[model samples]
Target: MDPRLFLADLEAKPAALRNLASILTVGDAWAGLPAPVDRVLLLGMGSSRYAAEMAALRLRAAGLDAVAEYASTDASWPPGPRTLVVAISASGTSQETLDAASGYAGSAPLVALTNVPDSPLARVADLVVPMHGGTEEGGVACRTFQHTLVLLLDLAARLSGEPRDVASLARRAADATEDLLARRDEWLPTVADLLDGRHGVYTLAPAERLSSALQSALMVREGPRRPAAGCETGDWSHVDVYLTRTLDYRALLLPGSRYDRPALDWLRSRAATVVAVGADVAEAAAVVRYPGDDDPYVRLLTETLVAELVAARWWAAAF
Candidate 1:
């Protein structure tokens, strides 16, 4: 069971995402509640949690009142009636998310975005947003995660009363995926060569790319057959930098504002084999660069495709 096959499978299912637009169109009625929502509480864990983080950022940027918290946090301190809880889980059966949904005290509506529509998360949600990607065999997320985030963003845009051209966005995102898949042969071999026999891997990024770091770690672990970890740029320097000398690890840095550039440079100087995504790679071990759109939502979609390409290469070589 070569995991790289999963990437190929994902590429074949590019229309899986376009199908989500229809799902959202049918589910759009949920966006038109009698009263506008006062706040949104997004809950999930691991990659699902990261998806919520990305969605929360988009919602905030659209001036939609929203916040993302771990399902455990939500379970401990639930929100009130004015809140809408959007629970995201690829496997729909994540215990923490289910438990949080069950335990939420508020009269607020519950929305679930999941690949497994029959699972418990969907059963509990007032409205279910089904992701088109099928089951993900490996523990890491690939197409499932990508579709989940995009669908959530689509829903957020519709609900926030923002002018989101879903058809245009979906088409562009699909095109980006196609572009990366086309170039897989060129970059895969290089990534595989660089990551061959590597023991530890670390991904660093700021803000939006922070979710990319988390997704990268999962892809390497589940797809590339490696033990991996991820962190924010400043946090990595303060906490994980010391471990570089003791443990053999590869670091991939995503460039952010000027604040992240200095830290990224320092990490590179420390002899960490850094790979840059969505930015220029200078003396880095490998670079998976993509043309990103100015829209944060679009940039996130592009970054995800780059990560998938890198993960597929590593998986082909290592697994």
Candidate 2:
């Protein structure tokens, strides 16, 4: 596997975040822009879909009615003047996103949130908000994901009618992520040793925050050529519990979810291993922690650094 390109994309995140911060500052006033519509539809696919999910959360928290839909399918909503569709794509070339953006252009104004401003999706969008993660040739979205989260926060600031220091928050996100990256040697090997030769790994997160679990599974599968599954906190009981037979599966648990510890206990008896990141859940067989502040939104960005480290380690070992 050619892992250098993937590693380059992952490593570029800190600078990408800093660049986003500089551009999203209070003075820039992008966040100060009035809400074009009270309802929002965010569209993407793969990890870009995950970015849309996070952006929907931020937008909803700021009191907007927002939903994220897979751009691969045709989506519909009640016709209203205060409705907008935002297409998010890292490459800005996804056929699904382009089609969705085009479909929505004549109805509600289409906004393009993408890394490549000149790409096809961008061309169809009535408004363009550059993702500014730079070019990612890794075939996976890494830094672009981070950039999207920061932009979502900037959007939240704008929609809330109370602009925040988005740049400062981005700096904090960069710092927190940097601290985790600094300890790659320590955390990566530990996770690798536990996961080495495992049949597959399961990733768990709250149902409300499925992006964490989805991205975790994506990293392992894309980086290590490993079979991986992502699950919601409650759904794993009915669906994923069947993996308990051989105890060959490991789990990367994103703690702070609703049913984590109880699920962790159940998984410990069944799961080969469970590693907790950010939250210190004692039930986990191993714990890799990062410094996170009070903002749960920032945790969304920083805590993901642990999964990135694990994926990178697996690449090094396999290659």
Q: Name model 2 segments beyond 4 Å from true.
A: 26-36, 78-80, 162-164
Tens-place lDDT per residue, model 1, 1-319, is 4665676666754576667655655556245332567788888888888888877887898888887889877343355666788888888899988888866534567877788888988898777777778666544567787787777777677767788776567667776667667777877667655655356677777776578788877777767667878787877768877867765567766666445666666666676676666666676778775544445555566665655666676666666
| Model 1 misplaced stretches (Cα beyond 4 Å) | 1-5, 21-34, 61-64, 74-79, 137-140, 244-249, 291-296, 316-319
Question: lDDT (CA) for every model shown?
Answer: 0.70, 0.76
lDDT (10s digit) by residue, model 2, range 45-93: 8888886787787778777788888988755675455677778887889
Clashes of 1: 0
Model 1: how large is the Cα RMSD against the reference?
Answer: 3.0
